[model samples]
Target: MADTHENAYDEFAEAYAAMNETGSWNAHYERPATLALAGEVAGLRVLDAGCGPGILTQELTRRGATVTGVDASEQMLGLARRRLGGSATFARADLGKPLPFADASFDLVTASLVMHYIEDWSVPLGEFRRVLTRDGRLVFSTHHPTMDFHISGADDYFATYQFDDEWFHGDIVMKMRFWHRPLRAMTRALGEAGFGIDVIDEPDPEESVRESEPRAWESLSTKPAFLFFRAFPRYSA
Candidate 1:
């Protein structure tokens, strides 16, 4: 990752977690859409990579998956531990480096809104492939290039680079950095990392959001706010 901020969420763990719990984009949109692609996680061993505050971990476990959450922020891990207790395992690990797991350790791996933080996908994608069983699928969600490019006001759509933004969680303001690359680059990175794309989705927000947050529902349903993918290893080792 070029603009490395390993503990980016550490300082705002509490505020972020609180916001994530019921945030229109997260709780109602991204999480639901991502989990739908995950399909039947029941009775499966899953890795929730970059699992902040165990939000998705809790949902995965609730759906009968044995979940292990990993993140670079110790503070976020603390919140995850407190939230899930013995329901899921957690460790402090950076996605830019090797993951601490044995080969073929999981049946599924999810990296929700996490990959954009790392400029390079090779290391983490390889690690995810390494840890997944032969039949395992990697399902993830990330910022849509269209959205990023629009927000960044970058001249070249094909260029891969980093950008900065600010997030507001209640009264707390968090400055964040993220990577932006064209759609082709994302797929290329997956192919080079030994994954074969099975599904590429631009999802609509769940119906529930229509009543609660009509504006977000309308915007998310019509626009490309995020991109989702479900891929499996191309050649099993």
Candidate 2:
């Protein structure tokens, strides 16, 4: 099911990029969190896993990081290379499989707006830990379980369960699998994946977001639309 959704993205990469450039489609929520988690990327070896159109990759490069962006969609990578120029390298790879990089290769790794589609996130989280240098950080964001539940027409936001939803934006249609995990589940997943949580931020909506999409912004400000986390590889003395 996940693979089907991924392949669908590969087919609609162009349309996706076009819509995303406007900062609509939850861009205001995602971009700020990426920037906050990836502070001072200068001189860092960074990996942008599941990089959609390479916008975040370009941002990391602009901050002086040596960034490598990877995605399963060839079309997306092609668009990334075009927009990013030669500033960063872009590769095609699957998120469900072991990352193609060697152990201890990166100082930081990030995957923005990419986890909800994954059924078993622990696999890639463990793989990410394996590729990080000791003390390297992994920062990623995902749709808030509460937000997912609300958007999916679920009546109860406090329900402790998974909910399935389908999103349709014009011609692009895909199914989403959401895990409505409480904070405990998130921390436990990080611990089991050999990472220690450093920070978990649920930011308020910016003014622009508030003005542009008042209802969404208001809802998100009160209840987070997304969750961002910074985690570091666990060290044993």
lDDT of 2 at 11: 70
Model 2 accuracy (lDDT, Cα): 0.80
Q: Which ten residues in a row have the lowest lDDT in candidate 2?
A: 1-10
> Model 1 — which ten-residue stretch has the worst lDDT?
1-10
lDDT of 2 by residue, 133-167 (tens): 99799999888776777767777665455666666
Model 1 / residue 203 / CA error / Å: 0.8
| Cand. 2 TM to true fold | 0.86
Give lDDT per model, in order. Answer: 0.91, 0.80
The C-alpha stretches of model 1 lying farther than 4 A from their native spots are: 1-6
**Taking the tens digit of each residue's C-alpha lDDT, what string does model 1 give over 39-91?**
99999999999999999999999999999999888889999999998989999
Output the lDDT of residue 76, model 2: 85
Alpha carbon deviation, residue 209, candidate 1 (Å):
1.5
How much is the lDDT of residue 221 in candidate 2?
Answer: 73
